[model samples]
Target: MNKQAPQNSVRLPERMRHLAVDSRGYPVIATINRSPEKVDFGSISERRKLALGTFDWCAVCGMPFADELRWQMVFEEGALPAALSGEAPVHEVCALYAAQVCPFLFSPRSRLSDEGRKGEVRESVVRFVGFESTSAVIPHASELQPGIHTLAFEQRGHADEFSYSSPDELGERFADALAREKPLPVSDAEAVLVRLFNRLDDEGEGDVVTGAALAAGAVFAKDIFKVQGLGAFQGKSYPTAAALLLKGTEEQILKFSHDSQDEAFSAIGPWVLERAGRFPLALQRWRTRGNSMVKNLGPSSPQGPGRSVAKNAPCPCGSKRKARRCHPAGVQATP
Candidate 1:
């Protein structure tokens, strides 16, 4: 491992700042090994790979994933059948930083140090596929060695391909991609807004709120807050303003979920009253329901073990049912 302090040339993402640095001054990802004597960036740790499923940790920062959507980099020929990926899930920022700094990703001609690894030396493309959930973990079919596991996503989201000659150029491309996101259809946006508001009304100013509604509301409020000053939905009615907010929110959710679901959930009332210009009664209902909802959801926890494990595959917990029906009902297996 590199004893020298990390180079300041690359501004790593906040989550990656605490990672172990290699001799090249690059922060080693959680899936890579960093011992006292050496930092092996070429190989992934099997123990950590398993932990990805067991603990629902990000592959890059090794932290538990929260409300943010899961992301994974896919090379030209690296995608597996049924939307499964050998690479573990990571945060969007982590994936973007890795693409900017990793030689194999940013430099098209750069080859992996280990030629024996899967998809070695092929033309590289920084393609990030997003997902709503980490669906499953099964033995890696592509790995010659045993005990290697692969992760699967339940539902894939929008994907973008980035091409650039330099890291700065790549950053520009990322920004451009976000800017190019098409607005959600007006009808769809109105429906989402009306539905959420109606749910809040139906629940009344009481202390209880549904989990699904709370989750959706948090996502809605957060996205609306983000696009607030972007010069959208100005001088509109409460329903129209909220619908426009939903439109912007849907666009954002299509890209990635909120970073803090709790914060977003809490902000619903403030956003409605201040931004959407809603009445006091609406704000009161939001506060009452949002507060109760947060208490019920508790603090954010690991999103897995997912409920999409293959019925014919061995349980992730090392069980061997005859028909491999250990996860028949998609219940979490003990890790």
Candidate 2:
């Protein structure tokens, strides 16, 4: 008897266009088995898993990974074993899309339909870990698994806890996930500077002396300081409060410019002018004290702004060896 494939009415992502959709319009991933008119979403096809690991194919889109980093979605408890077992890795976009749309992954109320697995609870957080692909054989698994050699990065997000009864709620969750992953546009330097400055302020550092503060300062120097003009800051003196702010800002700009002359340039005039309207009294004391205040601010560190840790010194991560050799050698664990 010839059986017809289920009609796919779902609007799938571009990468998942070639995937076969189940009767419910959910795209069946590459690892799912669909044979003899039966589709088992709860189980993985060992053959397909083997092939995916061997050929470096995405488990969701079944396409070859064009980039060096491969991603895997891991539940809280299964993270360690999943990494060790060499489970199939998917493209980051594919993993993110599946995280939002897959019922068992996205919905707290959706239980596993497989027999004896119906009682499993959904985890509150889903972690996506990216690593370079390294094929290895495991004791429990018969075929080779897509083992991880070095972890590049990891991201965590809230898993949907509410039982969503409508497509609208699901779409909202999908949009939220997409928004979280989107990077800030480079043209919006003001917004980036605001965020970085806010973080620096929260750290309670009057100057960029701490390692954390220096890191943040380096970003501000590279992104915001080098491009903007500072012609409007014509104040002879700034108020005490404004003078303090200017001191820290000027120090960061000068220190960063000294460290990387080609990458960053000192421009305090524009920064002060931009804030002058909002903080009218900030520069009132600057005319009398600005030059002396800047001179007194001093350097952030003995080595300089960006070079907090020496290349030969131990990394802050607590690894015993030198930073340049030890830092790049291991997998970054999931938090």
Count clashing pairs, candidate 1: 0
The TM-scores of all predictions, comma-separated, are 0.44, 0.37
Q: Point out the worst 10-residue segment of candidate 1 by lDDT.
A: 200-209
User: Against the hidden true structure, what lDDT does model 1 obtain?
Assistant: 0.44
Q: What is the TM-score of candidate 2?
A: 0.37
> What is the clash tally of candidate 2?
15
Best by lDDT: 1
Best by TM-score: 1
Candidate 2: residue 278 lDDT (0-100): 34
